[model samples]
Target: MTVDHVRSLSSGINQTGVRAYNERLLLSVLQRNGALPGGELARRTGLSPQTTSVILRKLEQDGLLHKGVPVKGKVGKPSVPFDIEADGLFSMGLKIGRRSADLLVLDLKGEVRMQLRETYDYPMPDTVFGFLERGYEDLMSALSIDMRSRMCGLGIAAPFELWNWHELVGAPPAEFAAWRDIDFSAEAARITDLPVHQVNDATAACRAEHVFGMGREYRDYVYFFIGAFIGGGIVLDHAVFEGNQKNAGAFGPLPVPDVQGKPAQLIDLASIRALEVRLEADGLDPRQLWQTPQDWSHLEAYVQPWLEQTADALAIASVASCAVIDFEAVVIDGAMPATCRARLVEMTRTRLSDQDLRGVIAPEIIEGRVGNNARGIGAAAGPIISQVLLNRSAALLGALLHKLGSERTSPFPGRTYPTGSVTGMPRAV
Candidate 1:
């Protein structure tokens, strides 16, 4: 369907949708607080006890929740605490990067069950699709029929315009240009016949962090994923803030000074591409170095300058971002090795510490736990977030309605919002 048509779909918040929302809320509560009794879940979610019990029963039957040992209270009978069942569902996360393709099968608890990765010069439509198909088949082959049936959906994480960075990626213009006409999510949907969601690779990485990593501890943070190009995402009040164009944290465009003291975007100095450019100038195989940062120890001459420049640019960006929204942490992740990430984080921290802090509280500079897999894992979560975690159709409808600032007749056959409403899109990030 068309984008406008999808947005026009009514957030059917009838009695049925209320149960769905409650089911999600119950899962969220248990996930955040561990096992809790039905009464506690109801109290936390503001759902009626009877409604909570009913939803809990249904979720239990669906294997999405499990009952723990009963706990006897002082004033009441023993109550069984319910917890999320990590194996109840699964999502397929795929990342098509400029240099590599990765596929991961993630369980409900965000654990990776299967991973397949390949390095290539650049992604070609046929090769990328073939890689995904093989990966999906391998994943299904490893699962039972019942488990396979529980597959929530597929999430594709890639750059919005893969062909646009041909120069940075060292790809032929004509070959890379082919990506301009390819619709990644649609093609995957056609091949897999599974619900597909697409997101910018950086945003997907941030979502991965939000759902499985630092997000558990901090709700507000500015996420920077240092891949081929520096990418960013923002989280506020525990939800990713996607701007009108779904590119709120496009950090590559943030301005910074270049080596020549000329004004340039952060991506020019802080991204892996910048390092690659430096390495290439010194007659080293950048592709090999990209895969193995540990080998860069001998190339200290090139590495030191890039690290210094990158740290400076990141410090400036972190200060600017915190000044605007006051994030609690600045998470840096990348396609490079973990040691590289750690060193970068350390350098960034030092640079940030040196900055003047008169009016704004400096956000903690931290290394991202997801690393390079963030985008793929987050993409895999798209289907789960949309189908099980929350009622996205309802949430998007509510957003469109709110944006319009008035009630309008919805063409879809469903109840309008009244019973309940979810506030954010399931796959916005």
Candidate 2:
């Protein structure tokens, strides 16, 4: 954003009961624009220098922020840039998918510090919770005691109606039916005292992009994540626009054409599960799709057709999405090879040309920066953003982030405004 525009976005009003708001405002501003000296930070947030200095010093003392090396210009005194301390706080993300589950730990800066993965033919609650319990123990034990105490909470990313996919995963009704009674937040409490948060797995991926990837470049975009099931998330006004039900971008059901020109939901034609089916039909190992240090070169002969079909459907979804929101771009990302993501972007761009655009302005089709396992990465960010950082889009979302987890607790406590200095998107750092 231009300096003038960013300055215009600042909201650093300090009042008797607004200390909580001011602290979040400083963090959000730094997250969006990177580190800044006290004066510039104060100017950006419209806070008096004395108040800014007090907040900055207090944050630094509390380990939420750290100062950079002093830089002396042709000006008066040397200025030190204050940045979020990467090791100041930590959060966890758990992503439950149709074919696999991943658990990861991320620092305040949205960098993954540790990760664990488990794969299965299908999902069962016992297995998922088992992994969560084990992974939680292993990860926490690995951290220093100080960092462990700084853990914000856990964020979960799973499907809205996880049981409905029993047919897709080929699991028995009784096994899948158990998910109906599973409350993610309640389950998390059994494993840790940290507050719990949950989001639609696809929306979590979109959140990952919005906080740490190219989604920040646009005020609005439609995000499609091609995973076990082709799902989606929406971003409006610079934030991940999780709708009233936290399922706004559930784009898998968007109508598209099948290989035979028959009507099909985007998921039918685009999901990795369908590709797995094609591979299994040909006696090729579908397990390779989820293998670590992923290398799909040997499977290229089978992958090309799937990419073509998936790209075509995605192009249509992009058009339909933009027809409603005028998104500046359509970001296509997935738990697949980087080569596949780039190729899909190109093919989707080609297919967009074939779409009828009489009333729609075609959005730029772009490859997503956050690659495979984005769902887990995004999930890990939910708790930190919900509590410690700022979410400018919360006004549009109506303070719903706290609902993701069991409870929301701020590292710095006081009443928080729904929106902060960050104009759009949740500031994850």
Clashes of each: 1, 5
Name the 10 consecutive residues with the lowest summed lDDT in model 1.
6-15
- Residues 1-429, candidate 1: write the lDDT tens digits: 332222122112111222355577677666656789988776666667898898889998977888999998898799999988888787788898888889988888888888988778777888899898777766666766556667767899888677888987778899879999898878887666677899888989988887778766776889999888899798875677666777779999898777687899998889888888898887887777655323566777887888889999999899989989889999988887777788999999999988887799999998889877899998998877776675322235447656544433333344233322232222110
Off-target runs (Cα >4 Å) in candidate 2 are 1-19, 393-429
- What is candidate 2's lDDT per residue for 1-429, written digit by digit as tens? 332322222111111122366788788777767789999887767677998999999989878899999999897999999999888778889999988999999888889999999999899999999998888877777777666667777899999899999998899998799999998899876776567888999999999998888877887889999998988888877777777787888988889888789999998988898889999999987988999887888888889999999988988888888888798999999999999889999999999999999999989998999988789989988877766666645344444544432234433365232323344433211
Error of 2 at 49 (Å): 2.0
Candidate No. with top lDDT: 2
Question: Looking at candidate 2, what is the lDDT of residue 145?
Answer: 60
TM-scores of all predicted structures: 0.83, 0.88
Clashing residue pairs in candidate 1 (N, C-alpha, C atoms within 3 angstroms): 93-380
Question: In model 2, what lDDT does residue 108 have?
Answer: 84
